[model samples]
Structures are given as C-alpha cells and as structure tokens.
Target: MPSKKDKGKAKATDAPPKEITQKDLEKLAKDVDKIASKVQHRQEKALAKGEPIKEKKIDPAKEAEMRKKIEAMVQALSNMEQTGAIKASGRKDMGDHKFWNTQPVLQHGEDVTEEGPIDPAVPRDQVQQEPYPLPKEFEWCEVDIQDDKQIIELYQLLTMNYVEDDDAQFRFDYSAPFLKWALQPPGWRKSWHVGVRVSSNKKLVAFISGIPAAVRSHKTLHHLTEINYLCVHKKLRSKRLAPVLIKEITRRSHLEGVFQAAYTGGIVLPTPIATCRYYHRSLNPKKLVECNFSRVPRNSTISAMVKKFKVAEQPSTPGLREMKPEDATQVRELLNKYLSKFDVAPVFETDDDVRHWLAPTPEVVWSYVVEDTKTHKITDFFSFYTLPSSVIGNDKHKSLNAAYMFYYAIDIPEKEAADSYDTARYTKQRLTELMRDALVLAKQADFDVFNALNLMDNSMFIDDLKFGPGDGYLNYYLYNWKCRDIKPHKVGLVML
Candidate 1:
C-alpha cells in the first residue's frame, strides 16, 4: 500500500487463509483406504496362522474394572439360583444346595466324607456286629411277686423302643408302666413273670410276662396265657435270647396248667398264625396328617369319618351268656383246630402256656362258644376281656369295662367235603357272624364299647361289622430275624 518493503510487509500481514478443496479431501481418503487395507491384510495373515489379531493395549486399570464387573455378574446369577429366584441349568440342578454350598464332595461308599465339618456326636462307624456276649452266670428264673425290681427292669427293657403304632390306643411304654402296674398292691405273681438274669449281677435284661385267662360270656372258657413285654437289650439281641425266654415262659405256663398263650407283633416271628387287617380312626385330621397316620383325602367326608368315628359305638346284640371253667378242654380243641388252619401258631403248645392264660382274676378274660346243642359240639367261639375303662374326662366311666375282641373261631363241618371251605373264605364268614354275636353280647353285658383290631386280612371283614374305628394300632418287628411268608393276624383280645 505504500513503499515496496512496507507494502510487502502489510500485504503479508493481510494475506487470506487457504480453504481445503475437493482434491485435498480425495487425497486424504486414499491415504485412509491404504491404511485400512494394510490392517485387513495383517489380520487375514494372522488369522490364517491361527494367531490372535493384534490389538491396541488397554489400560490395566480399565481391564481390572471390566473383570470385576464380570465377576459380579456371575455372583449375582449364583445368588439368584440359591434363593430360588432362578434355576441352575444342567448338572448343577441335580445337587442339593445345602450339600453343594456347605459340604464338601463325599466319596461314594466311604465311611467318612469331607462334607463340611464332621459332627462329633455321630459315630464314625454305625454297623453293628453279631454274637453278643452273654453273662457267664446267667440264670433263667420264674418271676416271683417278691422280685418286683427284676420284673420292673424287664418291663422297662422291653418297652425301651415302644413306638405307638398308627393303630394303638392307651399308649404303653412296656417298662415303666409294667413296673408300676406289676408292683401295685397285691402285686403280680413272680411265677407269671419269667425273666433271665446274670447270676452274678442279677441284672434282669430279658423277660416274657403272662397273665391267666378266665371265663367270659356264653359258657365258653379261656384257658390261655396272654404273653407280653418280651424285650432284650440291643447288645444282647444276637445271643439268640428270645426262644430261650419263650421256652422258660412256656414252662411257667404249663406249671400253671394253661394250654394256650396269645400275643401280637408287627411281624409274625416265632409263629406265623392268622393274619389281621389294619384300620385307623384319626383323632385330629391335621395331627394325623402331620404324624403320617393318615393321608389327607380329596373327599372331606372320608376325612371327617376317619376323624369322628374314633369314639362311636355300635348297637349291642342279645343271646350272650357268661363263660364257665368246665368248658376248658372243649375250648382248647376248638382253638387248636382254629389255629391249625394257619402256618403259624402261638408259642404255647404245652400245658404250661395254656395254664397261665386260663386262670381267673379281677380283670378276667371271658369266652363265649355258641353250640349246636343237638350235635353237642361247639359251632362258634369268641373271646373278650374286661379292663378298667380308659375313656377321657369321665371319672365315673373308668370302671370295669369290656374291650378287645381278641379271637374267634367257627366250626366248618364240611371242611373236607366242601371244595370252597378254605381258611380264607371260612374266616371271612365266621368273622362276619362273630360281629353279630359280639353286638348281642355287648348289649347283654350293658357295655358302652367293644373294640377289636382289624388285623391284616381281617380288614376286609371290618368294613362289614359296623365297628367304630380306633385311633391306634399295634406294630410288631422281629427281634433278630426274617421271614418269607408270615401272614399277619388281627389284634386279639388278651388280659394283662
């Protein structure tokens, strides 16, 4: 704008900035394409050689952050599964969470496992061995009333594992109650109570008890011993002790002039006599369900019936008469034939077992035999007994009461002639008729209740009898044995 040098300085200061053109933009694009192609070629070559692609290095701090996030996600999933908010897939589902989370994996069949910390209370080995040692000076003795302590101990030992079955009433713990009852004033005779003792220590570890039978209704006699409270210690079970006890009891029974002995167990060990069915009358439906006595049914009426029928009474029948002692031998023959139909029979075959079961007492057992007077032979026989009543909240009602329909037998004159006169069918018909007879006798005796156990096959007959169901049933287990086909029997009445 002025002189040549000044003008050039001014012009330089005022010069305009150059703008980017399409050509320059196209050149930059080409350079970017070249770089991308080189990167692609490198990646292809690396991939062909099975090498990971080259990546730009990331910050160690960022990598740690990313790792923590992934770990947290995994933990959340596990937590959800544990809380049942989510389910685990595959093999994890098969394992119990308590074992998986708390216990270490255990080796199969090993006595010990790494499942968490071992419980010090539990034994390392649980298998029991056989051939238990018996006391050197052990003597089998008849129970004398004076030997109250020994008798009490024997009862305690037998009832140690007394679990009331789903079908029993008036729960009995064999030991304590037996001791208390046996030692009451005018205590049970020592002869009726048989026990095995270590001669040195006089520790009464095993025993078998019996009570004499008496007359009941219908001119029938009961000459039998009711065997009960048989028990042995766990350590002494392998000593083959029960049969010895049985033989000793049988001897005592014969000494007492008894011919038959009756008892019950879950399994028919020692004897495989007649089998009985089971029926349960529930007291509390909810409680029964909780205790597994009865399952909750879909029909409320069935459930209500089981719950309410526990104390209901059946109508009494007539034509019953008191039993007589003179009828002993005839009753014996009838019972023998009755028992002979079954593969299992009671342990008492000798006069000993029979004598003990037949003696009269305040709590007398009675028998009634309906006879064909013209034929001068017995047609049917039923046995029952009286006990101090066990009805709750009624002190006045707790008097001598007749309970337990123990056993019954009917004569089948055409057994050999009639093809259909087998044990099962005959038993069913006889039992049905026996119910009618029982009702008649109950009414004549002015009894408020008559109870009978629906033993194994007898369940088929129970539904027909209109007998009220009971809340409890007896359970039996073998002391140290197994059986192939021991048929079960109904609960027969016996006097203690």
Candidate 2:
C-alpha cells in the first residue's frame, strides 16, 4: 500500500510515452533540489523562532489552488520513483483510469446495494495460458524467494525504489528477513512471487506478488488473493509496465483457481469499500524531531516532549507475557470469535494460521498474550511488527524504528442486551490498558514511534493514548468483489 502524500501520480497513459531522457530527469531533479532547499530553510527559520507545529489559517481558495500546484509538481517527480500507483489529488473524479475503469472494480461514485463478485469466475482451462507480454527488453520470471541470491535481488530492487514519505524525509527499509516473513506466510506459492528481469542481463527490474487467503466480506466467504509488493524500477515508469504486471498477476491467480483479489492504495480509485486514517504515537520524541518525522510545539522543549510521551517501565496488565507456540489454539479461538463481529475480516481456519501469523518472530514481529493467573486460559492478545524507515539526509539519525499495530483479540464480556453500551465501554477501557502496555514494550524494544490505522476498536485508545492523526489515508479495495461501504470500526483486515 502507498503511504501518505507519496501516492505517485495519475494513471499512466497508454499511448506510446515520449521517452523521458536523462537530461529531462536531471532537470526535474534540479527543480526538486531548489524546492527542497527552500523548504529546509523555512524549517530552520521556524525552529529558530520556536514556531508551532500546527496548520496555519489560510484562505480556502488560495490554499486549494496552492495545493493543486504542489501536488502536480510532486506527483510528476514521484511518479518515476514512488512504490505504489496511488495519487493524493483532490479531484474526486477518476483521472484517466483507462485500465481500472475497464476492470471489474467498482466505478467512482458508483453505489453498491448488494455484495458479490463483479466478474464471473473463469475456469482454469479458460484462463490465459501464457504470461502477459512484457516489453521486448524485459521478460517475466518466478522469483524463488527461498533462493538467497534471488531474494537479495528482490530486496535490492525494493530498498532502492520502495515507498518514501511525502517530504522524502523517510523511506521504508524492509529487511531481507522481514520480506521473507511477509511473503512466505502459510500456503504461499512460488508462482505467485512474480518478477520481471532484463532479457539480456537477467537483472530483476520489476515485481508484483500475490498470496492466498480466506477473506470474508460480510457473510460471503471468498478464498481471495491478497496482492501486494507491486514495484517497478524507477526508469521503467514510462514503459507502461505497471498495468502489465497487474494483469499478469491476475492471470496467474486465475490459473490457481482464485479470482477475487484484495489490495490497498493511498489514492482514491474508482471506489473503495473502506477508507482508514493513520495515527502516530511518538516513542522517541527527540529522535523524531531531529529527523523531521515530527515537530515540537511553539513553547515546548525536547525534554518536555519526551516527558509527555513517556510510558511506564512495566506493563500494568497482569499475566501478560510473550506469546508461545502452544497458545496458538486458544489464541485462534479467541481471535476468530472477535473477528466475527467485523463486516470484513480474515478467517484463520486452523491453528497453523494463528501460529504463522500471530506467533512472535524476533526483530520482525512481536506477540503477547494475557492469561488468567489461575485458570491458565488466554484472556487477551496483541501483536505488532517492526518496520524501520531510513531517515533521509539526517546526520545524527540514520533510521527511525517504527512499530505497527497488527491484530489483537480480547475477552469481551457477554452483552446483557443487543448493542449493549456497557459492553462497548468495557471493551474500550480494556483495550486502552492493553495498548498502553504495547507502547511500553515497543519503547523498551527501542522503537522511535508506533503507527496504527483507525480500524477495529482502535479509535477507543487513539486519543486517550496521545496519538495524533496522520496525513495519509489507506483505501481498501476488493477487486472483482462488490460490497457495501464498511465502517472503519467494522474493518478487521490488516495488510503488510
């Protein structure tokens, strides 16, 4: 999925693209350098005056006009470098979604009163037999993730070209171990790890991947394909390879007897079944401020900011400990029951699913469970994953460690009546306590910040825990599936 404000640009044009020459790219780079210098100077001036870190009042008309111009400039440059094909434009209408409009996705502003697949499933025999034709210079290949050399190749491609923040101040640094953990979940397939390479040199240049999962949209259960890690080399943007990669992946998924797919983007496409906002809880305030990941208040000092975000040294929740393999069964039962309350959620049908996803993996993921001190039964569980970002142009700090909230389940008391207010209130209070413990643990692990989306019951703790809203929005899309809008609280799905 795309991050805030880095959603690249408009959909690529199909017409033969006028090749962007090296000189053209250099000129664009120079223009961006000038803008960046000016912005940096402004930031230094603000810091000198102890400026407030809040939006300034501005005329609506002027703000809108100014925003449009900035977006255009950023989009044009980022399109060649961004990791996702999403855009952060103000225009609600689809702009040259020539390919998406033709696909089975819901049209922009289209109403959905019913839920089901937008396109009929095709038989395996009828699916495309050969891969989609890549440009003559490039050829398709199945990346052997198990192969160290191949995985490293994929890692290098992403490390250089993956997502960067709106200001280019930070870029996600997905470790090789982390990539393996994410792409090789239970029932993963080599065929789904699609990649493209230069035909002559066999150099991996572009990639897109899919993984099988049992996702339920309301009452309809679909064994859908979760699409992710769509990346194209920066130089190949004008080659119109993104659509081709998507089509190829779709074809391969169809051949595997899967039709429907789920993906997310930062931009508004034809339609989105749900839109979630991001929230950030700073752990290392001093580091965040120095990296430009955050800013201090007008009258605040770095030490004050740190004190404001500090957490207790120990967890308040009794019996909470690191999750173990044996806890998978109990955790699975509790998680499934909790997820059932959501309109859209994953179905962890087996204990292996629980262990594979929720069990802790050092430095990559962390999971903990609360137990009944005497009963020896699981009471609650929470999990988060590590995803550090490279701090661009920061001399003191080279990276910012970030922990992302993954999934959790708690023992909600039985409702006395339908829609019981007391039950909801209790749920909020308990979640707040557990999540605060999570923050403490993450801080102990030396993370600089914790990030989460406003899905599930997260809203209950966000404000109480001092999490500020972020500029990014993640739009959840179900390809070939039509479902009514799902409220953020009713969404239980989380994508890596």
lDDT of each: 0.43, 0.79
Q: Write the per-residue lDDT of candidate 2 for residues 1-496, one digit (tens) a residue.
A: 1253334232343311336532454466346435543554464456458885243433323533443344333333334333334334422234568788789988876888787888898889999899888778889999998899999999999877777765667777888889898888889999999999999999999999999899899999989899988888888776678889999999999999998999987656667787776779999999889887778989999999989999999999999999999999999999998899998899998898889899999899999999999999998999999988877788898888999999999987666225554566578779999999999999999999999987888966887798875656677889998888876678899988
Candidate 1 local lDDT, 153-255, one digit each (tens): 6555544423222222222333343343433322144666766777888777776677654321112334556566676765677566776676566555555
lDDT of 2: 0.79
Q: What is the lDDT of residue 96 in candidate 2?
A: 66
Which 10 consecutive residues of model 2 have the lowest summed lDDT? Answer: 8-17
Winner by TM-score: 2
Q: What's the lDDT for residue 466 in model 1?
A: 50
C-alpha displacement of 357 in model 1, angstroms? 2.7
TM-scores, in order shown?
Answer: 0.42, 0.83
